[model samples]
Target: MADLYKEIGNDSDYGSINDNSSAQTEDPQTSAPSPSPMTRHQYIVFCGIALAYFADLTSFSLIAPFYPIEAKEKDLSPVMIGFVFSVFSLVQFLSSPIFGKLLPYVGAKFMFLAGSWVAAGSNLIFGVLDELEPGTQFLVFCLVTRCVGALGASASVTAATAIIAHTFPDRTGQMMGLLELFCGVGLMVGPALGGLLYSVGGYKLPFMVLGAADTLVVIINIFLIRSSEGMESKTKGSMLAVAKIPAVWVIALTCGVASTGMGFLDPTMSPHLKEQYNLSPVFISLVYILSGSAYAIATPLWGYLSDKKRITRTLIVFGLTGGGVCFLFLGPTPLFPQVPTDQVWTVIVTVGLGSLLLGCAIVPTFIDLLNTAKWYGLPDDISTQGIVSGVFNSFFSLGAFVGPTVGGVLQQHYGFPWASTMVGFMFVIMAILIVLFGFWEYQCGKGRRRPPNNDLTRQVSVNYFGSEIDDTEENRGLLS
Candidate 1:
């Protein structure tokens, strides 16, 4: 058996020997070395970051199933409810990019603590506000607080993704696949727990639990997490330098659409169900749990496929468009007052609606979109990735902003069907944009601009993914 251990330079950081053969290796047949203790340390911080990220997202997501229930409890209009959710998305949109810039200077530890505290404090406050008032127009305040909370964790997701991506450079897609697994688990578990808590305790329970959990996340980040400590750049840089790269523009747009699609399915869907069918709280909770599972299962498969076939962009186009059709099924059908609440058709309709929402392919498209960010000049550092991710997340935040508020109005005024109906159209638009961007890149040719060995990205599309444009002189010498 191979020794599975070896000595190499610069073991303090989590960098792997890019070319182990040239890294003073003992033998090719020798067993690969176990990751040094520092690597394990990095992994722990990554996991903590993931935990915080997951907790925040899931905390908000869990609200999906309960939206209608809360509406019923307060007799609040759907439009008002939509505004609350959209506010959180909007916060992420404006601040995520800011986190990117602020993180490098303020550091992840500070931002993480800041974000967690914002989330915890606000959640605690929301419970108090909700209990004291009826029709208090507190939606704006709630949203503002949530936005602040979101800003705190704004850069964490992309930061974590970039860290893992660079840590396992050769298997970036595979590692991303693993990352999505954690993401899926967080999303799935968060909503389910919320539903159960709501059923068992009441509306306030979910907020209380999330507030406490988030506070713990802050503590962990402060005490347990260690920074990657990146080296300085060889070349001086500026925004103009990054903007001049065409690939970056294409990636920014592509990621934006993919993110929009992901938002369409979850936080928005629960409210749609509530108004369309006038469903009860417990039932909505069940649906949310189910939907979360769909994402969880679909994401890992998408990552694996993107890795195996390197079909990042194609998958993005396919998943966004295909899964989008599920929203169409959710569009309001005329409701007859005479139809029994327990009619067999209700079950049939439920079965048919959003069915494709959980298929295995969703993860692939999403992974490709995120991977595309790096191709566009996103810094490889975790902190830089956070800022870069914040840029795309702005679009996702846009979707989050739009999905609920618009869906709410349409659902309230036109009925639940119309709210979802609009989302299906957004899906189509996103899909078209993805295809156009990808085709342009393909036509331009895979000149030296692309990494010399970007096989993983190439595999995302079974079709030839690029053109034969003239190679750049800078890349003439070596692999990307």
Candidate 2:
């Protein structure tokens, strides 16, 4: 156990074991310099990113509580409703990479502001959808507006991620966590606010109110965010090159798996609670709020731990394993026949705990991916960060697209209990694979000799061979 922790902790980036011979050929520009203290300018940039993230997520989730009911009133089937929701993620998944590739050429500030404006416009257009009579026209409008809104979201989110990474390279994990905290708050606030607005007016009220607020956020940021210099990279980043690395594949899967768990719950969880526990809609909303709150509250702590303690891999493994246990109880799966699924407390506790762990698992992934790619050979520039951010968003959006569609089908055919169990099994399987991979890495490290100097080369040797290399003559001997 001690050896495993040492292996994981010493090489938190999970540097590609097979690519150790390539390290000497790596671009020295890829090496991250020590991070300086935050300046007033950085704080301003962070605030802008945080507000933008909050608005993006709030608008993204705002329709959740009432959109299905409105769609049904328009005579759309459940599958059609699901399509409307899934299209957002689908467009985001496709467009994120494109925007990422363009970031170096166009600049992050331009993409961020432009995307915000587009999203705000889409929201305003969607507000008037109620005016159209229910039928094919309504469905067509829904899909078009959702696709446009998703494009805007993809641009803004991708740009924001790149900006934060470049602006605070040393604290990438912590900043990403803070942004996710805003996202969780947005998720919590969107439904409650949407339900409130829906009560006061009708279908159009929520979109109108939120759309106007989103525009307001954009206007504020226009002045608050300055164009950062030195953000554009000389070399174009290749997503294909980054994707080819095995370490990146592991990180992407970790991200996708975590998102899949969350996405699956969106459509199925409400209905399951209503059917099994007989909870009111308000109570159901509270349950979601509980989960979001847990996620929001725990995200920052996980980020702090990752940055301060360098436990990125450990958090990912722990989050997945712990989340799997929570999911089993969340359904009070038949596996645990004694646990009462009928009780409201069971749903609340398990979902909250599950989300808490989910936050821990996901918050460090961006930084982990960034460092891993750089360690393997990707340039450490704005271009590389943009590409990495794009790939990360694409995987996350892919999971979102797949999860709800599959979750809805599984819930329809099997029961929520089984559906939930399947998700649990996915988490456990991934966790086990990570552990096995770590053991294999440890075994490989055992064959290398430790060096005496314990300097920079020592760190490099540990990263590559799980052992140290002397800074002097031994370095040449090992390299040759």
Candidate 3:
């Protein structure tokens, strides 16, 4: 049995050797060796990163269930509340790129510590801010503090991405899947925990507890976390250079737009449901849990398919198009005119369906963006990964920033239909742009101009299952 096991392992390695040899003969730089397995130290770092990420997300989301109520007490309007929510994302948007650029120089571990300190400090302050004199000054103070916290949160994210790219460069998809899982868990757990804390001990307890939890994560990073030594890069490229890539710009735009669709709901959803259906914090938490659960479950599946099947482009197009439809049905639209109004059951059903679809759709967008960045002259190295991930994160934060700010103003002035319609329209337009870009890229071979990469060329003949057994130069003509 031991001999048979050895024979099977040898055969597996032999097949990989043959495939690698043939593939490299076409373009030696296009492919690299599969990444090495994780050492015990690497595993420790991974845990630290995951927990830190979870803490970051939890800090951001802990206010989800009760922020609107707190804002209302301070006599804040929906639009003002939107600005308050947007401040963090806006700060994160600006800071993420800076963190990305600095990751290699300062090290991800140091950045993580710095960021954790900032986020935890600001979060603890949020609980007591309302004790200050009320009015516009109070609102300004709240927004300012959240923005500071956003800077810290941005650092944590940048460090996390850099560590993953550095440690598991060969299996970024799988590692990222784990990252997303922790992200979904944080998002799901934060709101539920917040709601429970709010019910039991009022508003300040959630912030205090979550803030302390984040600080604990900071302590872990300081002690257990170490750099992925020897994985550093000294590339001199800038964000401007990455932005010059047409495909990267397109992917970034898609990310921002997709994020906008979800962001529109953040400040508005809790209040809207409370007004429309009178949902308690606990019930409201359930809505977020369902959506987050769908996202968490679908993320790994989508990542697996993209990696194993190499159907990244196909999935992107399909997911975006389908997600747009979900947004339409989510809003007050003709498509779902029959989804009953003035009932808790209606809100539960419609929102659940929309969240599920949105979850499945969002999984493809980031992976493809990360995958496409390599094709557009960003070398597959730690330095380049920092910039690419930063840009990717910045665009998403930009959307998050815009969605709440604009959605608040729209909802306040124009009502739910207008805001929801605006979001749905953005998704539909993004889907169209992505499709057009693919056709133009295919026809002109623009994506192939930079590197000797065959990703765009190979994608021509792939079936939905990702089978490309005949993917070769000879088959390129068939696509034409």
Candidate 4:
């Protein structure tokens, strides 16, 4: 290509050849060279990661529909059930940062494999919990086992995210969206299958199936998935280094607040449905399934839009604003229906719509936040990416931990209305922050304008080998 350019430059009669070549390269009508087999291999690796992610989420969410039922049998209260659910995220939140710091040295592949095995072991134990005498012993065992499983999830999820960021640094939004699609599908399938399986056999069956699936994934990764260490940096970077950035803190806060709103439904929703409408376990799971379906469907669309239209800011602001509104209208108010007696369908429809709106906003927020982290000079290396992934998960897990724990207490005392209102207020505050910080700090702060291309500000490019390189500042500053 360089020789052709030089040859064209030497021709006085074809002075416009250089311009034509440049135009041709940029034109959609022009065909580029076919991708190498290595590119195909990268996609296969992505598939493996997706599968692992699916299994990871399924193992956890599988318990969502029926765990409350199990607790009730043991004479446990809503707060206790919420604690059982919260324990998982609590452990996950604490473990993720440690995993992040270790990722630079251990590599994502190793971390994922180890995590899968641990999670499988924990799920297997959880499956057999019914064998124990029911009561405090049972609840204690459940909490402990779930926390152990969370430890594994922390490792696997953070590593998988880091892997995606490393694999598709240039296309992180699209790839993250694809990952979320898989995860959302897993979340949907977990509850549906768990509920059905529980109806047939028991909770034991769901855990066993998901545990076995994760075990199989570990084997598949050993054989088919390539090493991710190639993308990792030789020297390690500090997690604190990434955390020091103001934008990183902001993004983490946003993710935490958003996650808290979503977490409100976990403990409170199932019980709310059962008590208010006398919904069966299967119907309860269906509610979550519908929400997960919406989430899965919307993720790719948001990702594609962020990538193609450079609408990260637009999506973030819109999603947060819209999600906040949904939360406000989530439960019965003076304006909204309270799902009165014989109004079962009304509650289902309204909650389902809220879930759909949450889906639209949450996934986009994640992609945009991660993209912003990278743009804020979060080091374009695998190790650094891993830390960012861990930090992201940590914040999200923290929110998940707090939401159910607090929301449970609120719902138990006041009702879903109070719980929903609190979550709604959080989203409202986050939306305002996004406009103030997300837009102002990066877009209109001082005298600087946001670059036309989101990545242009970073001046980074990916080579054919999938390595990130810095471009010339002059060339990078050009409008998209």
Candidate 5:
């Protein structure tokens, strides 16, 4: 197993012992031995990351069920409420890159623990906002706490990605997918739990309970997460270097567009169901649970397929295309006048299917970004991992920021159908762009001289993109 790890670069399907020799010789320090199978310590770290993801998302989503109602009582308008939700993503979008750049300096373990602690503190503060008399003071405090929470979420998430990539270099996609599964569970659990707690003890109880639980998870992680001392890169990585890669830009765009669909639904979906189907808040919560369940259940499978089958690109195209079609029918939009929007079953089915496909589309993005960056000549080091993770989170958060802000205004003015249609269009367009990019890659590979046996650069490209474009100056210029 150790020999296999060294010989194959832990990428058995594409790289052979001969092929990896150059990579190892070029940067032996960075090409440390890979762990082919999970170690006991690795399992502990994986579990800690999973729990941290679960806790972070649970806290993020818990407010969904009842925050708006309380906000209404405090005289906040729909747009203002939307802003409150968007602000979290806004902070994450702006702060994630900063955190990524800093990950090497602070260390992943410290960032993870400190971030979880900050998030926990914010949750406790958010619980108390309800105690303030309804006015500007209440709204101001609400935004401030949410911003703080977003900062913590960004820091923790960036660190978590770096940790995962470092710990499981070979299984980044599968691990990310599994982590997302926990996130999906959190998404499902948060609202339902929040609604229940809200019923039993009102707003304060939900935050107090979940926040306390999150703090506990952080405490356990303090012992479980090992320091990333030796894993740190000798040189700091540049976010600008990662951003300059054309393929990275494509992945980032796809992530942002896919996330927009989710963000669009968050602020708009419940009201749409309420207005059209006359469903109660409890039933609406169930709708979200159904969607989250589908998303949670499908993510791990997608991740496994991505890593094992090397179908990352295929999955993204399929997921985006299918998800777009689902969204088209989600509102049973104006474009699909034949479909009935008034039926409860239509809403449930579309939302569930859409969420599932979106999960498939999103699960492979982190690994895809990592692979693409490596293919483009970025060193596979902690700094590179940190920058890639930051880029992924930054773009996803940008979509999250844009989605709710725009969706709220669109739904308020134009109605849910049009808003849904707009998101559907974006998905389909992105899928088309990805397909076109693949075609161009194929064209570039055509008629090029076959690379030599030990050509690590060409082998890396073949491993990732299923193409054999030569690593020539001309080809690099063309790609860039």
Candidate 6:
């Protein structure tokens, strides 16, 4: 690590290593050391932040099985139950908009801590809220708690993403991919745990358990994740900065619409399986776990493909169709019993497709857009990443707010099949939007010639225990 300044800071012919020269280098001294358990500090930071992702997804997704249980406990009608799921997203929509204003001022560490407190508190509150007099008010209270907890998570998500990006700015494409990988893993494990645990216990126990886990994770996070730049005195940019970019908005909308699809199925999944095939909640929970597994497996692979400069949006188009087809056809064999008698396999493929489709394409789509946004000048830091991401996520939160309610309506009127169809259409919308935005970005990036690799642009590298993490800048967009 001789002239550390030359490698990380100097924007000379040497600092931003060209593809050709990049290939020539092999020494571990100038590159990020391969991930190993020996790197305990790095592992803790990566895992801590990643666990935060698991916390958010797990906490919110924990409701999937609990939805029916909650509805019955509070004597909630169908509409009231739908409100319970959708209301949380509504709160995310309302609160995320202003978070950008406060994030830079508070810094990512503070933001992560704040979100931890909020999430833990929300869970505690949900576990102990007063009974509502009428209209299943307690049900609404649960949604409210989820929303606030998610809002609190907003800052942490940004912090974690930015911490990685800012720390490994040159390697953001892959690093971010890794970040998503962890989050996807969290998504998988959290739901599986929740689905399994909640089925064994009841609503109150699961909420308390999730709350305790979050509190513990945060305590670890406080010491584990630290910004390379320390705390930036100020993070520049606005929610409007992202909003004003039509490309950005399109990207955001894609996520919003995509999430709407996820939200549609996530809450009502228990009911759908129960009604359609007379299945147990455990079966539904298993489906979610499998879906999450698919996502976790795909995230890192997609990120690597992005580094190779393959076509990310192209992958997305197929994902939408794949996901759409899965949802369109996904259901219990008993629902269409005459078609086939192998109920388990039928459910597996449908749920697998639904899971795989969403996993294969959805996370990458948003990550690609975020990379594009960062190249446009978004700083790689937690609060800034949070605000920028939050803007996109807020749009998604809006869609989430609407998607479940719509699904509930369709289920109320027609049934599970029709409700699932409503979810598929959202993928259709996301695919269309990706086509539009990808086209726009392609044209714009095409107008500019490829700059020399050594050109005076930023360099990103990650070092753990004084070892370097190799991240290249050429891999900017998801498909590069």
What RMSD, rounded to one decimal, does every model reach?
9.7, 7.4, 9.2, 8.4, 6.6, 8.8
Count backbone overlaps in model 2.
0
lDDT of 4 by residue, 1-480 (tens): 333333223322112222323323222222222323337767887888888888888877888778888878878887688778778888988989889888878888888888888988898899999877777888889888888889988998888888877776556667777888898888877776888888988868888888898899889987666675566676465665456456667767777877777777877888877886789987887787776677677777777665555555466667667776666565654345553545666556656666555555555555555554443334567767777788888988998888877887888788876677667777778878867874455344332232233343233233112346555555344322
Worst 10 residues of 1 by lDDT: 1-10
How much is 406 displaced in model 3, in angstroms? 2.6
Q: How displaced is residue 57 in candidate 1, in Å?
A: 3.0
Candidate 2 to native Cα RMSD, angstroms: 7.4
User: Could you give candidate 1's per-residue lDDT for residues 1-480 as a string of tens digits?
Assistant: 011112221221112323323224343223234333446765676677667767776676666567567655675676567667667777777776666555556655555567667776776666555654456555556566666666655655534544554455444555555555666677777767877888987878888888788778778777766555552222222233234445556545545544554555454556655654677877866665555455555565665555555555556666656655665555433333353443424533543334334233334433443444444333345544544445555655665565545544565576555555566666678678656664555444321133333332322121121334335444333222
Scored by lDDT, model 5 comes in at: 0.80
Q: Which residue pairs in candidate 4 collide?
A: none
> Where is model 3 more than 4 Å wrong at Cα?
1-38, 75-78, 199-203, 268-284, 335-350, 412-418, 444-480
Model 3, residue 132: distance off in Å is 2.0
Query: How many clashes (backbone atoms < 3 Å, residues ≥3 apart in a chain or on different chains) does model 4 have?
Result: 0
Cα lDDT of model 3 by residue, 173-221, tens digit:
5667677788889987887788889899897899899999988888877
lDDT digits (tens) for residues 265-348 of candidate 6: 765676766765777766766777676666666767656544344344556677777787677666432244465533556667
TM-score, every prediction: 0.68, 0.86, 0.79, 0.78, 0.85, 0.72
Candidate 5 global TM-score: 0.85
Model 6 stretches with alpha carbons more than 4 Å out? 1-42, 63-71, 130-144, 170-204, 230-235, 267-282, 308-310, 331-347, 374-384, 418-426, 444-480
By TM-score, the best candidate is: 2
Shift of residue 419 alpha carbon in model 6, Å: 4.3
**Pairs that collide, model 3:** none
Task: Give the Cα-based TM-score of candidate 1 against the true structure.
Answer: 0.68
